[model samples]
Target: MERRFEPPVDGRGAQSVSVPTRFGLATREADGDWRDYMEMLEGPPVKLRTSVVEEHPKTILTFNTSPDIGFDRSINAYRGCEHGCIYCFARPSHAYHDLSPGLDFETRLFAKPNAAQLLRATLAKAKYTPRPIAMGTNTDPYQPIESRYRITRSVLEVCLEARHPVTITTKSDRVLADLDLLTELAEHSLVAVAVSVTTFDPKLSGKLEPRAAAPAKRLAALGKLVEAGVPAHCSVAPVIPAITDEFMEEIVERAAALGVGSCGWIPLRLPHEVAPLFREWLSVHFPERGDKVMSIVRSIRGGRDNDPDFFTRMKPSGVWADLFRARFRLACKRAGLEKPNFELDCSQFRRPNVGGQLRLL
Candidate 1:
């Protein structure tokens, strides 16, 4: 049997604590010595810290024609997320940088400082057609580093200046920091925000998404967005069976109570390296139900670790699927949550005054 890597665990009665798991590292550091195994057993005395590298790309807007997803274009201010959600599907993209899809996906990050400028140039193109530009499509735009870099905020400023419609999907309450911009966009029907709430249990949330905002904070953020007249939607995303599924109803009820008119859930998706990393997470965090969790996951994922097919991937089948579907349907109905009709106003978009393209009606 291969030796398992153990992450640091904090003392329960400790005043302050930080636990970082090595479940999924985008790339492993090259071994300089055979004593690495000895070092592992002894454990490091210090906590792991995050490192960022700035990337300057010619283009900032990315486009895809995936039929299942709602948006066709998106902007990712950062290349890697620090949230450390073991189930994140975007982890595989790190391999392009000679990185693995595990812990490296969270700790070693890339930021595009020129994102706002590139976005402005892209929008100034005469041939550019306006559609809702989705933010937070790959990694959380409001991740911890956003406060320092403010790249996402810069991108939004460009959107506001261009009158370009934009949508945000985030797990951080930091979106509230741009309430002024968001409020103005909402007034013009140019923005909509969706906040993903995984589970209401803080302990489980810490174990699953160690760096994400607390569940309560996410709900409060959603409430604040709605109260500020921003079109907000709550998603009980990646509802892990026998794990996070238990909190679906409660999450929905809370969202509904917060004046959130729209909410839904997504089943767990274990694409690429995410599957192994999540399994490792389960073995370390919930060894008792690790097998059970995978069992239910496979059952709903067409009897495999994941269903990669387009339509079927998002829409699971069989009795277990039906049960989750029914439960979510009833929960939404009971909570008076209805599907939100958030059609961003693309007609209001105007080319930004850049690249020799002056603002023209």
Candidate 2:
């Protein structure tokens, strides 16, 4: 292994000071071995800057037959997320492109500018069948960069014009920007949204998911979506043991107070590269409970950092898992929250004309 010294970035979640082993590949230091002592004497390290590259994928829709996931078809507007969440399961994906799943996963981003066009073409196929297309399943569609690219918005426009059913999951207030479109789709029973809330503590939230919407803002967004008649739900995702797990009931109760009738929760999952990244975060932020947290996580994951088996992965078992599930269920029941079961109407789908125009009669 080789080491290179780069200036540390500020306001980011992962304290990825050292690069981890590359996945299935050997890595050599890109820069020369010796550092310039004169440069180190200059000043403190500079922050890591984010960069975006335009990716023109051949196809936009990714199909999965995994029995655990709810949807079979989904779309990712971007390849890398700017939110910099240390526990993001999608971090390992960056390795396929030879990028670091640590800092690089957040700082280096890829935007699919032609995603909406490809989606339209795919939906227009003669054999195509309409189902609720899930967005933000892999990476958040409304991450900070969405404000600039607007690719997610374009996709929603296409879905609306075709009267296609769609489901969205996000942690950003940016979703509110598309209220007009979502409201229209809601009227037709064609849309549902879930806002993920990890913790209400602003400090913990900032450390866990740097640059994403604050917890309060996310709750507010969920309230706004529900007020607009969209089938909005609260997602208490990745409930970390010895950390954010305590907030599960609080999140559910708050969402219920905001008129959100449905809720869901997922135990924290540390697949592949995410495990080390999360460990680094824990050491930096909560050193005292880091080991205890991992102990519980391993117990839930069958003595491993992760459980890759399809069904078992989704259904985390063990004492901690059972306890967490029980608490979440009791909280939801007390709050009068029901598990969301809003089925989007697919009968209204219509293939737009070749010129990307919808013929409304």
**Which regions in candidate 1 have their CA more than 4 angstroms from the true location?**
1-46, 355-361
Q: Which ten residues in a row have the lowest lDDT in candidate 2?
A: 30-39
lDDT at residue 190 of model 2 (Cα atoms): 92
Question: After superposition on all CA atoms, what RMSD does each candidate show versus the true structure?
Answer: 6.2, 5.2
Q: After superposition, how far is residue 58 of candidate 2 from its true place, in Å?
A: 1.1
lDDT of 1 by residue, 138-217 (tens): 99999889999999998988898899999999989989999999999999999999999999877677667767887889
* lDDT (10s digit) by residue, model 2, range 140-249: 99998899999999999999988999999998999999999999999999999999999998767767887788888999999999899999989999899999998999
Number of the predicted model whose lDDT against the real structure is largest: 2
Q: After superposition, how far is residue 359 of candidate 2 from its true place, in Å?
A: 1.8
Tell how far residue 360 is off in model 1, in angstroms.
11
